[model samples]
Target: MKLIGIILLFVTSMQAQNFELRVQAKTVIPGKKIYLEYITDLGKVIKIDSAVPSAQHTVNFKGQVKDQGAFYLLNFFDTPKPQKVLVILEGGEFIDIVADGVNDEDGKGNFTMKGDYPNVKYMLELMAISKEMETKVRKWNQEIQLDQKQEKRIQAEFTQAQTASTAKIKALIPQMGSHLVALWATNFLPAEKEMTSLVEIADRLGKARPAHPQVRQFVANLQRLQGVNEGALAPEINLATPEGPTLALSSLRGKYVLIDFWASWCGPCRRENPNVVKTYAAYKDKGFEIFGVSLDQNREAWLKAIESDKLVWKHVSDLQYWNSAGAQAYQVNSIPQTFLVDPAGRIIAKGLRGTALDQYLAKLFESK
Candidate 1:
C-alpha cells in the first residue's frame, strides 16, 4: 500500500508540471493559404497546422521538461520561407517587439508574464520609457498643429524626450545592456543619423563588455555600418550575376556610384525607382552609375522590377531577401536606401530623394 501511494503521488506531480501552448491565427485575405511553421534547434522545421476556411486555426504543443531555450513561431502565407511572428516559450513576463511593417522586419507585439528571468524587469522598465516617449511625442505633435512657434517648441521637446530615452538606455546598459544596446544601436541611432555619436557609444560598450556575445556582435555590426557611412570608403562587393558572369564592385571604381539597396516586392522602392531613373540619367554622363543590390528571394520578380523601372544599370543579388550576402555586408535593414559614392569610391551622401537627389547631383556635376 505504501509503494502504491508513492507511485500515485509521482504521477500527479508529472501531470501538474506539464506545459502547453496553443496558437490561433486569422488570415487577412480569404483563400490565401496560411500555415504555422515551428522552427526548432538544429534548423529543423515542424509544420504546426493549416488554416481552415473559417479564417482561424490553432496549433498545440506540449513543452518538454528538459528542453530549455527559445522557440519561434513563423507565419507562412504562400511563401517558402516563413516570417517570424511570436518568440514564444521564452521565460519572460513580457516581450516587447516592434511589430511588422513598423521600422522592423519582425512584427511588434508584447507578451506579458511568460518567463522567469530576472532581466525581465529591465525590459518592463524600457517598455514604460517607450510608452512615455510615445505620449510625449503625441503631445508635441499636437502642439506643432497650433502655430509655427509651437512647432519649434515641440521639436525641442521631442529632442528632449529622445535624449531622456537615450539616457535611460545608457543607464540600463550595465545590466541588460547587450540586447538593448544591439536593438537600439542597430535601429535608432542610424535612423537619427547620429553616426559619430553611435560609433563612440558602440566602441565604449564593446570595451566594457568584451565577453558579452550580443554586445560584441553589435559592436562588429556597427563598426561595419559606420565604415560605409558618409566620407568612409565603400566596402567591396563581389558577386556572380545570373548569367554566370563574375562581377566586382571595385571594377566600377573611378566613377560616381549609387549603391541602391532595394527589394523586388518593396512598394516604397518600386515607387522610388522613377526618381532613381531621373537621377541616374541626369548624372550618368558625369561618370555616375548605379549598382542595385536587391533583397529579393525570387529571380522573376527581381528581373520584372528592373525591366519595369527601365533601370539600365548593373544589378546583383543572391536572391535572398534580408539574408543576402550584400545586405549583411552593407548592414541594410531597410529598403529604398541608397548610398552616393564619390568617384574615389567613398560614400558622400545617403537616402537622397526627389529634389534632394537632383540638387545634390547638380552640385556634384557643377563642382566637377
Candidate 2:
C-alpha cells in the first residue's frame, strides 16, 4: 500500500511543493550565472536550475520540491574561482543565503544558510566539527611519524582528542532525530561502540522518510549494525585456528568472550595487543576469554604476531585477509573491531579498547 501511494504521488506530481532560494553574496558578480545542482547516486552532477545575479549582487531562484528533500550544490559556475555551498532543499522552504563569496578553507562552505533549514544547518555543523577533528588527527599522525621521542605523548593526546570528538559527535547525532543529517553524523561514530545508537537512528529515519532515496540507502547500509546491536545474539563465527583445527565462538558461551577482529598487518591492532594481553591476563581466571579472529592472509605473519605479542588466547583465521568469513559475518570493514558477548551469547558492548576496556572489565569482574 505504501509503495502504491508513493507511485501514485509520483504519477500525479501532487507531492511537489514550491520553494524559493534567495542569495545575498558580495562575491557573486552582477550579471554572472550561478547553478543549483544535485549529484546522482552514481556521483554525476545534474544541474537543475540557474540564476543570474542582478546589479544588487543578489540572486533569487524559485523551484518545486517533493516531500523527500534533496541535497543541492549552489555553485558560482561562471566565476574565475568556482565554489559551491551545499543546501538541503526541502519542500515549502524559503531559504536565504548570506555570503561574502570567499571559499571556506575547509572546503565545507562559507555561506550561512537562514530560514527553516534544520537539516542544512545540522549537516554543515557536523561537517565543520568532522573537518576540525580530521585536521587535528592528521597533525598528530604527522608528529608521531616525524618525532619518535614523543610517540607516547602524541598517542595519548591523539586518543584524548578522538574520545572527546566521538563523545561530542554522538551527543549531536540525537539532536538530528530522524533527519537525513543524522545519517551524515553517523559516519563519525565507531560502529562497534555506537551500534545501538546507530540502529535506533536508522529505525527512526527508516520510518519517518521511508520513501527518501538517501534515507533508504542509509538504513539499508546499516543492516549489519542491526544484527550485532547491543542485546542481539552474537553471530556464530566458526573458523580454523592457528594450529589448523576448527573452533567456534559458541564454544566459549559459558563465559564472557570478546570476539576480536584484527589483522597482523594492522599497525593500530598490533600496538593495542599489549593492552589486550594485560586485560586477558587479569581476567582469564574470572571467566573472561577472548576469541581472536585474524584477518591476515599470511600464515607465518599471523603466527609470528600472536607469539611475539604473547597472545595466548584461542585465535582463528581463514588467512583470507579481509575476505574471511568471520569478517563478513560481523561486517568488520575496519580492523580492531570487537564484540563483547555474555555467557548467553548476546552482545553486551563493542569496540572497547585501552583503559576503557580495562575499566569496564574491572567493573564486571573485580566485584565478583
- Tens digits of per-residue lDDT for model 1 on 44-121? 456665553243443444543222223345453445433445443322222332222111242333334233443445
Off by over 4 Å in 1: 1-21, 27-56, 61-71, 77-89, 93-185, 188-192, 196-215
Please provide, for model 2 over 1-368, each residue's C-alpha lDDT reduced to its tens digit, 9 standing for 90 to 100: 99999899885564356678898776766566888887543234678888777777778888776346776777874464467777776666788887766555543335678775668778777777877776876676677569867766876887888788788788887788776678667666778667787788888888888888877766765786567678999989999998889999998888999999998877668877877998999999999999999998788889999999999999999987766889878867577889899999999988888777888999998678
Tell me which residue pairs clash in candidate 1.
Answer: 91-115, 92-114, 92-115, 93-113, 98-108, 99-107, 99-108, 100-107, 100-108
**TM-score computed on alpha carbons, candidate 2:** 0.53
Score residue 145 of candidate 1 by CA lDDT.
58
Q: What TM-score would each prediction reach against the true structure?
A: 0.60, 0.53
Q: Could you tell me the lDDT of residue 349 within candidate 1?
A: 91
